[model samples]
Target: MPVTDITTDPQSLTMTLTAEFPAPVERVWKAFTDPSQLERFWGPPGWPATFGDIDLTVGARVQYRMTSPRGERSSGSWEFLSIDEPRSFEVIDSFVTDDGEPLDGFPAMRMTFEFHETPEGARLVNTTYFDNADALEQVVAMGAIEGSRMAMAQLDAVLQDLREYAEGKGTRVELLDDTHVRITRLVNGPRELVWRAHHEPDLIRQWMLGPDGWEMTECVATTTVGESYRNSWAPVGDAEGEPFGFEGEVLLVDAPRRAVTTERMQGMPTETLNDLNLYEEDGATLVTVLIEYPDKETRDMILATGMADGMESSFQRLEREVLTAARP
Candidate 1:
């Protein structure tokens, strides 16, 4: 039988998961706040991590594009709210891909994670609220529990890393917790040049390619959210890419900041909600992307694959293009 923590009540459904980490409260807290530390431990089993424009703080937002073991990428957002050092924090997580591109209908989640102090270590709690009984039952029936256990197994690996590195050659730890997959980059060039790179479809075309051989051979984005578009590409060499490769539907577009929210397929075709933002820092503009996968497994896969490294590499490519294409 599958293990789902969700329980049925009268009107709505609730899911709660609890786990204890064999580490001091303070160190655990640091892992939660620091972007670098958090990245090390954020995925499910068999998936490592790939981060994107990661800037974490109160009201500070970041984006992530992760790839699973099966070569699938999923994206999502983290809108931060409360920050109590390493004790607790809150955020409204949207499981969306860069595309609004469509996988049935999933609403955003308001999740509150609390940390409690224990004599041996610390206890972490995850609580989620569902709209109705049916929704609660529907998701629970969809392998939520089994998926969470796998994610926690991954978390254990993260804690071990922390004990090995941060806590120094000093602590022995084991972290057990379960949760769903609710899941980096840089760019160069002057402000104006960066701005132009994003505005022009021709320039955007140069670096948004997937893997090495996958290219966006065909895309039909009509501008802004609400509007929809499709992109198709084929893999190069011997790699047999995911089943589908036609996706990317606009969700939100912030022109001034050059930020956009989208629903994209699994780097293939399956609606995943996601968002991307381009910002100017000093004289150069930095682009950050976030993706939300629909399941724990998908999220874990994307994270473990070094999505951030891939995006940064793509941006480097974009930066060179901008410098080369700028009015010289």
Candidate 2:
């Protein structure tokens, strides 16, 4: 087990757990921040977790549900209170209803996660402060201690395999559910430059094109919430494809980190919610886009169109034609 010690202090109404891992602090941090890796071990043995789009910035909320083998589900939410990347973060942790309302009688707790470098590798110090002794006792009676131990134990495999998981994998797509899909790509560039590439028209036109013989005919990009942006592309020379375009209104924007938008093909009524997140490690950024469709039909229809393959092509061009040139 990764956990070396667990202690509770009724006087302070706090519980603390110390765990060590044989990995760098940054790698351990990513295991918690990335939803894909987090879901693998956030729940105990028979209970598996499913997380929503996780925004690690302060004031953002994250929701997740852990379902038991018997199909019972426990939902929770975390409101980020503060963040210091690769070092520590604090959150208001609460047992919540499916719609995210706090569950009655289950008081919320203040939780802090601290990461430190050790001679062997890295160490994680997790402390949770309750409002009172009763609150802390209630959580312990609910199997929090045993569950947490099992959950943290599972992190070892994740930290050990992250490199193998991402290395050499181009753009990849995963069906998250009936109506949601997640796409991820790792590019050799910084997060700021990658975010700019998506917003600045001049930079976008250089690499947003999916394949050769295509050119961006029009590009209108925006970062302000509620503002609409449009992008259209057409074939050049002897290229064999009709003109196509996409338009969307920005729902949220946190520069260099995350963005959310509503996207639709021009003249189409159906739309998808796109949540874009960027995380940088060792000078390279991992781009993750979670898309929510109106229904399974819409999700399946879009995937059938070779969308992932086209995205891979564009990402390759993005590295070769844009990011490389921007790097010093």
Candidate 3:
């Protein structure tokens, strides 16, 4: 992660900022060009920008508004002057009224954005020029530096999410049927490494805990058909809450590719059918887990418990513990 650096030069009547993202140049470029992505981080932390109109073509106008915490609104417009894909672009930006009219006597800026490739990742440079030095000083007095820094920090978070998704460390839940949920992701390792991580109790204990403040106390797994497995977990400290555990019987097993099991939690009302399917693509492993509940109501209730978030935390750990360890 890189902190955004902002500098203003009185001699040149310009303010320049630079930030780095841990992603490919092309992906980083898309974050600026894509309206959805831009909307996620275009404003300061609390004031989120909403793009009402976006036209990236030369001479086209773009309009957006940012709402404050107190419900106050600020509008702005940008007219694109030039664009070179994945490299650079220039726009004329200014404050505007609700009716899309530029504010009288307010300073307008010519902004250029440049993307550069680096060994670590992508570097973005933003240069904003004012017609005169007085305008530059006026905007700085309005807290422009602090605001841009906060907005760039938000962009850092957005980049992290995009990278996690691309590496298959993100969880995706799909409703395959009325009673079944299919969660699939590309795990960043070979089939054998991922299989071992799941089967080995020590390795499973490393990443199976859903989120912070919880840990698996005991784990027992067997891959042979007809064998039974058990797991126990509880909060990390004090352990005052009810313990969570599950018992399951393996119904089908195929080395590193597939497995079917039936599991019941100690205090849960229903038993679930679990199927694990694995596929190899390039050097990575694709994992698909299907869990079937007794009825639609049960499935919906479980999904509403924010189960996907816990799975996301677990898989993110798996990427570090299993995939990164297996890297050649």
**TM-score of each prediction:** 0.44, 0.60, 0.51
Ranking by lDDT: 2, 3, 1
What lDDT score goes with residue 169 in model 2? 94
lDDT of all the models against the reference?
A: 0.54, 0.86, 0.79
Give lDDT tens digits, candidate 1, residues 1-328.
Answer: 1122434353546677677778777766766655554554455532334455545578876655444433355655667777776678777666666653323465555566778888878777767667676766765776656556555544443454422332212112121223222212334456556655555567667865645666667656555656666655667678666534445555444464433444555355545555443444445444434455667666666556665554555566675665656646
For candidate 3, lDDT tens digit of each residue in 182-261?
A: 68777777888888888889789989888777889889999888899998889877645566888888876667866778
Off by over 4 Å in 2: 1-106, 109-164
RMSD of model 1 against the true structure:
12.5
Candidate scoring better on lDDT of 1 and 2 = 2
Residue pairs in collision within model 3:
none
